[model samples]
Target chain A: MSGLTPREWLGLEATHNPHRWYLPVIPRLSVREIFLFGGAGLAAATTALEETTERPVVWATAQYLDFAKVGETMDLDVHVSVSGRYTTQARVIGRVGDREIITVNAALGRRELDLTETWPTPPDVRSPDACRPRGYDYDQDSLGKHLDQRFAPTTGKKLGGPTGHGPGRLCVWTKPPDGVGNSAATLAVFGDFVPMGISNVASQPVGSNSLDNTLRIIDVRPSEWYLLDIEAGGIANGFGHGQLRIWDDQGNLQAIASQSVVVRDRLKR
Target chain B: MSGLTPREWLGLEATHNPHRWYLPVIPRLSVREIFLFGGAGLAAATTALEETTERPVVWATAQYLDFAKVGETMDLDVHVSVSGRYTTQARVIGRVGDREIITVNAALGRRELDLTETWPTPPDVRSPDACRPRGYDYDQDSLGKHLDQRFAPTTGKKLGGPTGHGPGRLCVWTKPPDGVGNSAATLAVFGDFVPMGISNVASQPVGSNSLDNTLRIIDVRPSEWYLLDIEAGGIANGFGHGQLRIWDDQGNLQAIASQSVVVRDRLKR
Candidate 1:
């Protein structure tokens, strides 16, 4: 069965410069069907560098400046700022025409050492079998359509949970389509769900436009399901800040993700 | 008496190119009087751009590539990646000669909005007055001398503390010299102390050399004392990951910072 490659999902194309790439903003990878979601752009940039340097991205932080609407193309220019024996620090600029949309800086490399520990134990929640699936319907109106989501018992309560009102935490079991594979880039895409928590906790239709998304990749292992543990911390001055922990099905901490978003109160509008 | 301006402390010199500034690595700013501390570089880069753009840095992340020693100088090249009416996204590269030492990406601007909230409450720890002062002495061998650190009651238990032997959390009240004003740049410096928590929680003498430090500025209020609530999480594959929340004395969440570090065991050596 032939299907689209992960690169195709990202709409990444090769450029004359090996360090640079061209990516298209397609609906399949967009959040609101209007612009490229923060995660998709992060995935494309890191994936391109992962393929180029043949190293895993240890940490990458992308500061989103503007948006690339569906049908727009972004030119990703990657630069290896410094190359060391065990690590390489790099930067990528994603632009559409003369307008820059996203700028990402990353550290890529792997070293072998004998220290390992994961602090937060996964909360004992019902398995995906017991949870309700969300955002799986292939709808152009929502970015959730691209992933399979099962709301854990702790998921935003007002939206249909064992509900709560204040900014607390949410947990969900989610996974991309089977074709995406297990990679740091995939982790980046899944790690962009903190905004969902913001809306969920608000219990009202609130919109959040992320100013920046930072992902720190801890470990990448093959797993069909990943759990998102999101904590919505503070909201002030029309902005919200939160942190998310991405864990595989086996409860292994894979990455720590954080974001700050510009809040849009739909009720006010 | 007129003190040296913030720019003078940063030693930022004007370049023929308006977009570029030169910075010197001085002992007063060095962590151990050798190489430039992570926070100093971050401060210099952001201060330079803050002066040029006449805006405050909202978020800045720096990936440490190499060290700029006490006599060496770095050229900070700033670029305005995107400029919006109320915000500007920019990147800065700090290089010594042809070698890149630090790369920083930041968001700068101030907007008027009516939403405000701070979630994380300050942990009930001993005040700086009740806690023991650390790194207060001007010691050339330690980074502590640069800041006044008062270990909260939860500080290292095993490395001669109340004695615990597992990865845990540490909280401290820390502040830069009185001469340094409280700005986002000052927060950046205080947020670079995860390495201390690593050593505190490890029990033994271990060193965590950070690969990158990312600071998400939440609020930059003028305060003499800032609290660092650091959680030292996973340690594996010879690396460690941790997150810190910066709070002002009034229990306001100022910034969320995280880092990944290369772990070194002095016992093994």
Candidate 2:
């Protein structure tokens, strides 16, 4: 966390051209050492866009098209479609060699306005220190190992565990080793938990592949631990949809994200 | 509805090339007779992508960058990034001349799976016929004129009315002149109600312009009147965020949409 930019933390390298960036898919940036994690890919693209535009991201949506393996590299090309006085519309297309892997569309910039209010209250839960550590089946070489997660008391089931019929809601306190210090890219990485919540709601160890991930920023503040309040909207026809409200320790809403995933049974994997 | 496809219904004219489409922004396709409606623009893009890919839309997201005023023609260019056996990844870049107005990225196709489930249930409300007709203050030359809207009994307030501080939820029954016949594009048009819901939650006659609209289709069935259950997420820094769950008369979830908008005082307009 020593004044390191998110691009440096994610091992994203800058080219001589301002609109181009690349990330080597190291083990820490991948999922189970198999492919680039969806959130990590999104974070890489976000960092690249922010660096090129020199603006804070307001909203970004990334669609996962293919996979970049652990040893491959993802090259991102930034395109600025419109640059307004107060906002900019841009996109980043990431590819490994000639094969496209991800496409991220985003808006970045801020307007000076007086109004500010948040209505959704955070769930009353114990602090991260009081919660039990979350358990996962993946090895240490995956992206999940880089995050420290704790299940709230309201979380009806543990990861890869059974659950009873309920409202399909899960609350978890997550923290990275270096902390999310006012970086939207860091929060984007944590926003990938919707798939975990989907499995909890299904009452089975279900595996999901995200087709799209959208992050809507309300406000980003430096915080050590953030709460991920995940709720499953619905699951139908082999697809699952859900949303998460990320909150700082003081109960301030940081960002809201929603995603749709392709659901499959874990046994098949 | 006749034998009209969604492209035909939206007046999207196809060019000799398969990847090109255009829409003349008529009053019925605009808002306030001033600019193209955000959802209509998205629906136009979705229609173009579907027509080009020859597939059903699973999810589509559009980022509104600029305005396409009434009487203007929007030209859409469809790009298929990946055409898999069961799913296709594509995007539509829409513009009025050289000004980019909207960008829509989508995934389309369906898979045969033995599993199907929907966790979120529709709210218990009276039939559409039992509700009072919704009132609006706009003229006849707008998209709102084509929609028949009814205030649900659970709705605490009407459009442009005062409201008590609550959870910021509004339910309404809306029907187009022609029913939504398994068309995701038609449902995309209805997904633009987040701004209206924002005004209701604020208890003021506020105005909002959409920045991004994301639609995730779960199941679509033909129905006369569809229920729009809108919930306001939060408002901060002159930006409003909200989501909606669209349901048919039979209580089946048709789609879920989330949006972010720039908030303004209606008095200024």
For each candidate in turn, the interface RMSD (Å) is 2.0, 1.5
Candidate topping TM-score: 2
**Residue B31, model 2: Cα distance from true site in angstroms:** 1.2
RMSD of each: 3.8, 3.2
lDDT of 2 by residue, A105-210 (tens): 9988877655676667787667788888877775558888878898766433333322222467778888864633657778788788899888877755677889
lDDT of 2 by residue, B167-201 (tens): 67777788875633558877898899988788877
Candidate 1 structure quality by residue, lDDT tens digits, B92-175: 989999988988888777666555665556666666888888744455744457578887774333432222222467778887
Can you tell me the CAPRI class of model 1? medium
Candidate 1 error regions (>4 Å): A1-5, A8-11, A15-17, A135-142, A155-166, A202-205, B1-5, B13-18, B135-143, B154-167, B203-205
Judge candidate 2 at residue A5 and give its lDDT. Answer: 73
Model 1 per-residue lDDT at A109: 83
Local distance difference test values of all predictions, in order: 0.77, 0.83
Backbone clashes in model 1, listed as residue pairs: A115-B236, A116-B235, A116-B236, A117-B235, A157-A163, A235-B117, A236-B116, A236-B117, A237-B115, B157-B163
